[model samples]
Target: MLVKTFRGAFVCTALGLALGVLYGGWTALGVVAILAVLEISLSFDNAVVNAGVLKKMNAFWQRIFLTAGVLIAVFGMRLAFPVVIVAITARLNPYDAVHLALTDKDRYQQLVTDAHPAIAAFGGMFLLMIFLDFIFEERDVQWLRRIEQPLARLGKVDMLSVCIALVVLLVTSFTFATHAHQEGGVHADKGQTVLVAGIAGLITYMIVGGLSGFFEDRLDDEEEREQEAEEAAARTGRSRSAVVLAGRAAFFMFLYLEVLDASFSFDGVIGAFAITNDIVLMALGLGIGAVYVRSLTVYLVRQGTLDDYVYLEHGAHYAIGALAVILMVTIQYEINEVITGLVGVVLIGWSFWSSVRRNQALTAAEPDSEAAARVSVP
Candidate 1:
């Protein structure tokens, strides 16, 4: 497993270097490396969150996620999405945008910066919602239950969070975003576009995510109810019912995991646009990030990391919340990618360390279980 993990990283590094050499040699290498590290650091929380969903997926889907999903992430969203965004926002033809980027690198960079605020806002709110939902929602943990019981019962105030973020974004976009305008007549109609884009992104995420959560909760309930039915039927002689129900439960779990993956990817796709306008660079950076994230998911699943580290999910969720706020701020204020990466790394690192400590404590408490079983065995 260790070898496999290292091999994947090596493959990505080689691909990056090759791309760099083909593009601009040493300059491109520096760009890819810097972007790779920045993306990896900023997206560790994504790995943590992904672990939670990936646990429920079957091996086949997991493989697909690693392979096809990387293509979507690295190339589709990273490279193509930025081009798409510029085409839509700037009213430029897609081919024209591509031509501009390839020929006039400086102009292309400027266009990318102009397009960032909306992208940032979209990602920011998406992440914020993840955090708020996680923090406020009920968990299986006894301690978390005690702390979040009131908030969980009251339900997530997502609308309120969106409203506040919008108000702030509008204020900042009016003031700071105007100041940031440069030589090109790329004056974004900050008022209407910011509100529409931010709200649209927020609403789209909420609808999809909320529907996904609703179905998931219903599935959980159905599983429990079916199990009870199976138990009751077992008293008579209906073994077949239990097997059928179990199969249904498994299918439901698969659907749930896919929806969850989509939710997690929403912010990541938008966030990719914030770094570079060069579709190639964006794809390379985000693709590398996706590879590591998927690898980490596989690691987490095989090792049962989430089951072991009780608070790791919580920490990741908190980081998600922070990312949301940062995204919102970026609607008006241009956040440095390096800072974003550092924040994510710090949060995830803290969670990892905490989980390790908890696992050690758990091991210490169960010190004699292995020995006890060994001594009793023939």
Candidate 2:
């Protein structure tokens, strides 16, 4: 299993280097490594979000995510998508975008900047949906029932969200739209297109985010049942059926992992534009991020880290929610990617540390009990 886990990542890294050598030589390798680390850093929140969702999927989907999903993420979205965007928006010939990225390193960065607005819109809305759903959706622990109850009730219809989106669009169109047009004048027409595209992306995010929630709820139900069966089996001293059921739950968790992986990769692909636009660099960098993310997910599952860090999961969901709002607003605001990433990393990192602190406190409290037990042990 360990060998299989690393196999695809190794192949991708090797292939990226081979192509880099043919295309741009050793400089390309340096670029790839730098971009990979950047992407990985920018996407730490993605790992946290993936862990929360992955606990609910089956194993088959997880394998597909590590294999095919990585390709789509690293290649289609990270590389080709930007080139395509540049071709359409920059009025550059599609071949020119490709050629520029390969031969003229200086110009490739220009095309990437030109490509950012549209992709940024997509990513912003995508993340917004993630945040909204996680916040509003019902969860097993009603710890924050005071806040969650109202949101969950409202989210049931999603009418409020729709209304809020409409208000945003209307306000943006009337206010920002006029301002943007006044500044750009003749190019004002394009502003409308950009606005429409942003809305479309937001709608798409809502659909995907809702689907993720639906699937997650179902998986949670399955987990509860499996847990009940395991408890019953333990009481009866029946091992075989309980073990089989545990295997089934594990498979579900793997599937959940894959879907979550795909969701987290959305922003990584979008953020890859900050580096070299050479398809090779984008693929290499994003692929490296994928490798570490997959490893992190597996580690979390094997160690049951999420179970230990209850608030860490909560922090990730909060980050996702905040990111979504930022993404939506940035459609017109031109927020920097580094800022977006850092915000999420800080939030999730704080949560993880808090979880660790909590666990430590629990452990410390337990030592006294252990000492008492020793004192009483006959």
Best by lDDT: 1
Model 2 lDDT tens row, 275-356: 5556677777677767766656655655677898877777777777666556555545766778878888888888788878
Scanning candidate 2 in windows of ten residues, the lowest lDDT window is 177-186
- Residue-wise C-alpha lDDT for candidate 1, range 229-317, written one tens digit per residue: 88888899877343333344444444444434443444454455454445576567666766777688778887888888777887787
Over 4 Å off in model 2, which ranges?
1-11, 90-112, 140-158, 165-191, 210-274, 328-336, 364-378
TM-scores, one per candidate: 0.77, 0.72
Q: What are the runs in model 1 whose C-alpha is more than 4 Å off? A: 5-9, 142-188, 221-277, 362-378
Model 1 backbone overlap count = 0
**Against the true structure, what is every candidate's RMSD?**
5.4, 5.9
Best by TM-score: 1
